[model samples]
Target: MSALLPLPRLPLTALAVAALLGAAAGVWPGAGIASAQGTAPTTQPSRLPTAPAQSRGTAEQASVDGVVEAVRQTVLAAQVPGAVVALQVKAGDRVKAGQLLLRLDARAAEQTAAAGAAQVRAARAAQDAATREFERQKQLFDKAYISQAALDRAEAQYKTAQAEAAAQLASAGAARTQSDFYLVRAPYDGVIAEVGVVLGDMAMPGKPLVTVYDPTALRVSAAVPQTLAAKLPADAKVQAELAGAAARITPVRTQLLPTVDPATHSQTLRLDLPPGTTAVPGQFARAWLPVAGSGDARVLVPAQAVVRRAELTAVYVAGADGKPLLRQVRLGRTEGAQVEVLSGLTAGEQVVLDPQAAARIR
Candidate 1:
């Protein structure tokens, strides 16, 4: 079964970005883009052919698939091996921090801890005896009843016992801590998304027992092409269309992870959703990101000027002899009435705005 909640009417930005991901994007299929700057092919307005849009605008918008994720989540894991004796919470249960979520049979751990305690007591008794002996030896040395060598031996024995006692105390404390790990507790206030172990199940150290997430702290994670990510403005405006939400929502903050994926050539973009927004971890979302940069400027043409055929994207260009010649061109993003041309037809070239009209003239 699909784990994701079904998304609503697909966002337009998602489709646009997904379609124009590669180097040679054929999104427009011979669509007209703005003509190059400083060059205009003089053509009559009523003529069958016209120049591409005269102005090259720079602002661009892109969209990509985003997934809702919790900003804070934890998968509780067992720190000591034991049999699962009790499970206090199941999936979807809300819990507070430090709340007991599961209990493990700690009979073996209890024995180990008791053994550690006995060792500590034994060490302390030995240390006390050593102390008394050293005191007695010091007094004998002072009164000349014992030799200096005998006093020094007693002092060394006392110090050795003191060290042993300290070591045993630390060992006992560690044993007690390990025993406490047999009782699993929630790390934070969150909903239990998963319960990995059942009563009577044997849990090994490092095995996950429960998954919890804070439902209120959510963000949208999307992967954007490196080219688009590099061009994103410092204060770029971001908007999101969350699954099941009535309208688009703005992110409270935007962040871009520095590392880029080697395989996909994309970087992860995270947008923190505002508080009180209805969203769940793993839900689908679409984010519109603004792409801004400067270059030689884009060539845009009217969408109606595009001529598409099987694997063919071209336009009828006015030849030197005033005849129509089909010219192939690569395309880019669409802006309202016009699309960007990545290559092929350039400035000073007369492109037929209406392919049908040019066909009749030919």
Candidate 2:
């Protein structure tokens, strides 16, 4: 025989409420209806807004990054090998044309010059003696005291001596010119940007000793790609300014180099800055060059629409059915907040402005 177990009794109000909740769960198909009336349902986020792809103009302008440089920048090098004896100017010092900047040990040059001078003197003395002898020979020939052959020899000696004197004089001048190489002078009026050698430092021929730049004249040099360079007009109006500057600068002139760099596939463009610009060499700058035509269709998209994943770059484009799809695109130069799409995208397509927001759509 099994022992009889006693059942615990519940309160009437609690029993009635539990019965009602059970009935409601059974009546509803899933937890959705019950949660909608009692508890809150987890809400899904909405997709981000999409922007239409814009067609770039046939003639669009591209921005160029470059460096500011002086019109006349020279690195003076040693023409003769010698030890530096004097360095008159330091970095940032103002200089004038023909100003002495440095001096090298010229003892050997001086000695050589002195020897040449002495040879000139000796040659002159010999020439004078020869002249006197020739005159005496002439007088003797007139008196019939000297043979015709003796007079002829005396005349030949004088002529030979005169030639020797002239040769020596030229040699002396050449030696002096070599001696002048020991002295370094400023080739133009400018500021000394750098001093490469110090006093007592040995300088070899063709080694740089000093660098100078004319601060008044400034220019910006930039390398432009071959494709865009071809579209530039003959007298394209260009605007340039210092990087992160607050002022706009009107270029004095613009010049495109005739040669192209094959390795970079770019051509050099030089823009002359107007007078009184605070631009200096080695500073960063930018120039806006007008493009005449691309000769092909291109898409332009907002910069934020592009998504980057390591080496992969893509954008979320809206399909024909209005569904978001990922697209890989090749990018060209950037202008302001928009980027030129070279391929993998076409005009009239829509792209999600925020890629992260579009990820939740699926």
Candidate 3:
């Protein structure tokens, strides 16, 4: 009651103005009133896109390629040098074994063979006369009409005549064989790949007259490095592709040439091809020789799952943490669509199909 004596009274408008100013100050920056009445901020979880389902299969280490080769090939040449009289077969002609391919001027050989035959006949006549004389002498000796020395001399003459006749017969047979050589015959059933002699061409010994090859017995030959030669097995399986046809072949033999080429450092490998296939010689081919003792249980995947980068090969493998990782892998042989994983992955592990996209993302 004592403090009320100094009090000053204010108008109603001034009191109302003071109240509005206080409210404005409360809504300005640094004031905590607006936050108390506002809603809380919210967050949403991120979602990654899912990959599509793809089909996959297991793979094994295998080698595959095609080779071109002739089944059998040989050069036909004249055994005796002479002028070519008749050419029966031409290039690209199919011929049977023992079919006449060419003929030489056989008049000379025929004359020689005829002379030898006449000599044999004359020798036989002389042998018959000597035998008759020996028989007559033997009868005389048995009756004591001729001396033992005389009978012995006749027997010696008869033996000499017989030996002469046998020699003549052998000479005649040789002459006949030489005459037959004038007619060149095919050594085997084959196609004439080349003709080196014309009708009037002079054929000489060791000179190629014709080249023949068998299409059915064709084989593929390849030069393998020395390092790889040791690993090749005698029974290893092989396949060849030629002229749009694929052939399955077996390793029948492996011939390591005694000499290795200084430049290539490789040896030749000859493979026996199956019958009824058409492979030609002088055609290039790619071959795979399986390394011996290199086969074992391995983790394999489809070949399509692997991608080649610069100087490296990579595969996409799904990790247990639900993320795919790009892995560099060493590869081995390829069997069909499957490939061997030499390193980087394990068995029963999941690998990404269409690894290109996965690799790109990584």
Candidate 4:
């Protein structure tokens, strides 16, 4: 019985394959462990301190955020369609009035003008010959050497030549005027804000090629709600706090736009920065407008409670479930540490007192 016993065996290739697979499995877990040790976990947002919102009736003054802008900003467009051949100026370059900013391909325009000039010269030559012929005919008729009919025919020919010469002269003028369109020029003294077209680019009529702005005359334009806009008198004196450390709170001339925006229900207020003020275009500005009436309840929160990201502004609102949720909000103006909340929150609701504490949520 002992001599008939036998052992089961696997093929040599199968055993080698199994050994390689087990080695690979072991290497994979070690690689995963190394990776897990090198990577760090994401940080969680910290819990922010909360406070109940309070209502503030109409105050003595209202402030609104505004952007400092150039009094005259223009996006220059091409008057003629052609391939751009040269660019004379770039972004942020200072330009003078009538200065050339760009040039387009002028071969076609030059050819047209040359042709017109040639026609004008030929027409003038024909007119001069006609005049000479008429004068000779008149002299012959005066001497009784030619008939009246011949002189009259010569006069008719002279008038026709004069008309033709006039037409050709007008054509030449028009062609020259059109040729001027191949050159783009600045309208006023300003700095080039942007260059939209490059050399060899096809520029079409009405296509924007560059933007220019007069940096000397800057203004701050803000959108004020219609409710507050109507209350402020037309002659109310406003003051703006220009941005930066060396900035001064100076009195600015305010012009209320007559129309109200239908969608936002706000009116645009243009505040002219006083002459000699050291402020640049596109800077942040805030204007303090005198408030008229009282008894209108509005919510005011600390400026630290609001979060700003580029064009988006938001705040942390505490829900009934004791969770703080970030919500988008529209902000009006700032009064020192306090800011006006235009929308997205109601009075008596709890909000995060410090937005920085929850910055990780963003």
TM-score of each: 0.61, 0.64, 0.60, 0.65
Summarize candidate 2's per-residue lDDT along 285-351 as a digit string, tens digits: 8877877554566679999999999888899998766668899998975768999898888898899
Off by over 4 Å in 1: 1-60, 292-362
Query: Per-residue CA lDDT of candidate 1, range 237-338, in tens?
Result: 988888777778889999999999999999999999988888889999988887655345678888888899999988888777776678888987666778
Give the residue spans of candidate 4 off by over 4 A. Answer: 1-58, 245-252, 293-362
* Model 3, runs deviating above 4 Å: 1-67, 227-236, 246-259, 290-362
Which pairs in model 2 have colliding backbones?
none
Q: Pick the candidate with the highest lDDT.
A: 2
Model 3: number of clashes? 5
TM-score for candidate 4, residues paired by index:
0.65
Compared with the true structure, what per-residue lDDT tens digits does model 4 show for residues 1-362?
56875777956786577667768877533566688899986655556688777788766677788888899999988888999999999998999999999999989999999999999999999999999999999999999999999999999999999999999999999999999999999989989999998899999999999999887788888889888887887677777777773444655566889898999999898888777677778888887788766335678887878888898898888766555788998886576887878888888888898776655454
Residue 84's lDDT in candidate 3:
93
**What is each predicted model's overall lDDT from 0 to 1?**
0.84, 0.88, 0.74, 0.84
Residue 204 error for model 4, in Å?
1.1
lDDT of 3 by residue, 1-362 (tens): 56666667866686477567767776443345577558554432112233322223332223433356675689988899889989998888999999999999989889999999999999999999999999999999999999999999999999999999999999999999999989989999899999987889998889999999988877677777777666666665544435444554454544455678889887766666667655567766556555654454566787778879899897777766646677888987565877878777766666777665564453
Give all candidate RMSDs, comma-separated.
24.9, 7.4, 12.8, 17.8
What is the TM-score of candidate 2? 0.64
